[model samples]
Target: VQESEIGTAPDKTSTAFIPKQNEQNVLNDILSSLHLTPMDVYAADNTCAAGSKLTERHTFFPPFLNSSVARTKTLVHISELSKLHSAKRVVSDETFQDLCDSIESTGIYLYTPIYDSVNPRMPLPLRYECRQFPRASGYVEDPATGIAAAALACSLRKHNQRYFETNNDIVPHHEHTNSYDRFEFYQGTAMGRPSKITIRFVENKDQHCDDTTAVKRTTTRMLCSGLV
Candidate 1:
């Protein structure tokens, strides 16, 4: 929030979010619900105002299974999902199986959904459609993600590595971050634009790392903006 960023008194929107009174309790609740803690709550002022979007992170543990530090990659797409309406109904729980399975080994997941359109002026428009299913979602797994960047950087630092491996040759793998963020869908890498940024553990020596390459672009994804 920089003062210089506001020059013409751009219409500002503010909404109060219900904060968690207890962290551990919320975490327990998430586990019970097959959901996760650290969920974001969104809101707005009026019908003319944009609606709020919340991203709820979750985890999944295979029945009778165990591990250390978790082997899963980033499970951050759940909270970024939109209030999807299809010719049918909310995607069947089975439709989410792949997502759930992907996060299975590691036990970490996220669910982000938008209730309104980006303009915040009218009820959010349902634009994206699925060829086989009915829902909208986004996955985050790259350095361009500001919030994940620091965590990713920390992971690199922890493992005594600094290299990331990805299938997208367009990506340089070792990306930098600009700021803390949740806008990954609209983020960029050397491999052109990708919907997801799958991160791999790489070793590095820097105890403290700061990268901002992700923030260099405009995040057009409403999920990133947290505006529905």
Candidate 2:
């Protein structure tokens, strides 16, 4: 596990997070509990551009059965979820249930960046809502999920870079880039077990620079701190 510190003020208290290990085993356990089998798990690719909403669907077969046997289907939707004025009203009842039933899955994870209701253009944090329905376990929503939060941060970083590269007209200079990305996640509010997650990404620029491009081959290091 890796840990880092984050604080807004010099003397104020800071919070940090350490990522968990044995992810594969944990994922398998979650699937098994829902009577679904795990499949080939891979990191999300940078396919969609920044600020673009999209959905990806996948299917997995039961562990003991062949491909022809029953399969579990899951859908993941990425979008800019609505903003909340207060934590007391985190999500609208109709919108929340509609999203939960939109897809059938061992679990459904929806990734969205929460913005300030007063200033819709300004992002307040990132959040993911998890819903699960199984034959034996019934329907339930997870209070918090660390893995899904991390995945969302990764996707945002990739898409942000793509956005800058493609939208040169908006950002004329290469030096002025969205290089430093930070996400603070608020989850479990709907279940009354509110959780906070902070994820930060710092991009490393290549030392050698020509007149062609201000920076090149920018690599990123992600640091996350909070409870899962």
Candidate 3:
């Protein structure tokens, strides 16, 4: 973080960590509970297909499964973070319980870009709903999750690159750039513990074997005001 950007604040502090990158397939087992389908259509069964259709109709892309600094989280993309409340009506208790037992994930992180609500001429940040549902953890959600915010920011960039090759665009034009991107993940509003996490990263592009354009890796660094 640049000193000028942070300003001359004596009270605020910052820290950084290198998050672990891991393969998380738990997304496959708990799809029904999250009311999501596999990213691959061929992997979707009848029930999964129904969930996929629902998300598609609602303008949500399929959930991107990734691991954070602490645990795995299924990142569900929604048009607006506020819509997650209404989603609870469709996600039944029984199915949600089944999801808790079926997977090893710490929780499902619902996220969306708040850009449309802001001026398109300016850069925008993403927000998050870090509702933890680890089996028997007795924790409902988090007040601040800087680590998860870092993970979400990196994964979203990679997700966008993967889609570009196929001409399936979801993210805005600015996000497609290989330059450093900044994101502010606002969470805990539902529980009255409003918190904000900020992250910045740059995608280091690597050419494919076929010489196609793609971003194969990213270096992420998180900066927050006294929030880990």
The TM-score leader among the candidates is 3
- TM-score of each predicted structure versus truth: 0.19, 0.41, 0.50
Per-candidate local distance difference test = 0.25, 0.36, 0.44
TM-score-superior candidate, 1 or 3: 3
Cα lDDT tens digits, model 3, 1-228, are 100010111111211111122323434445445444333221112121224432222221233444565556545554434554333213555555556444444566666555333433322233344433333344545657665666676665554454443455344445522223556676766666777766665446554554665546554444444243
- Let me know the TM-score candidate 2 reaches against the reference structure: 0.41
Query: Model 1 over residues 1-228: C-alpha lDDT tens digits?
Result: 100100011112423222234333432332333322222212222122232321110011111111223232232222223311111222344444443343242222232323334444322221211111111224222213333322332332222121111212121222332111121222332224323433233323333335843323222211222111
**Ranking according to lDDT, highest score first:** 3, 2, 1
The whole-model C-alpha lDDT of candidate 1 against the native structure comes to 0.25
- List, residue by residue over 37-79, the lDDT tens digit for candidate 2: 3222111221222221211110110111101012222322322
Q: By TM-score, is 1 or 2 better? A: 2
Candidate 2 Cα errors over 4 Å, as ranges: 1-106, 122-139, 169-180, 205-218
In model 3, what lDDT does residue 118 have? 41
Location of the lowest summed lDDT over 10 successive residues in candidate 1: 1-10
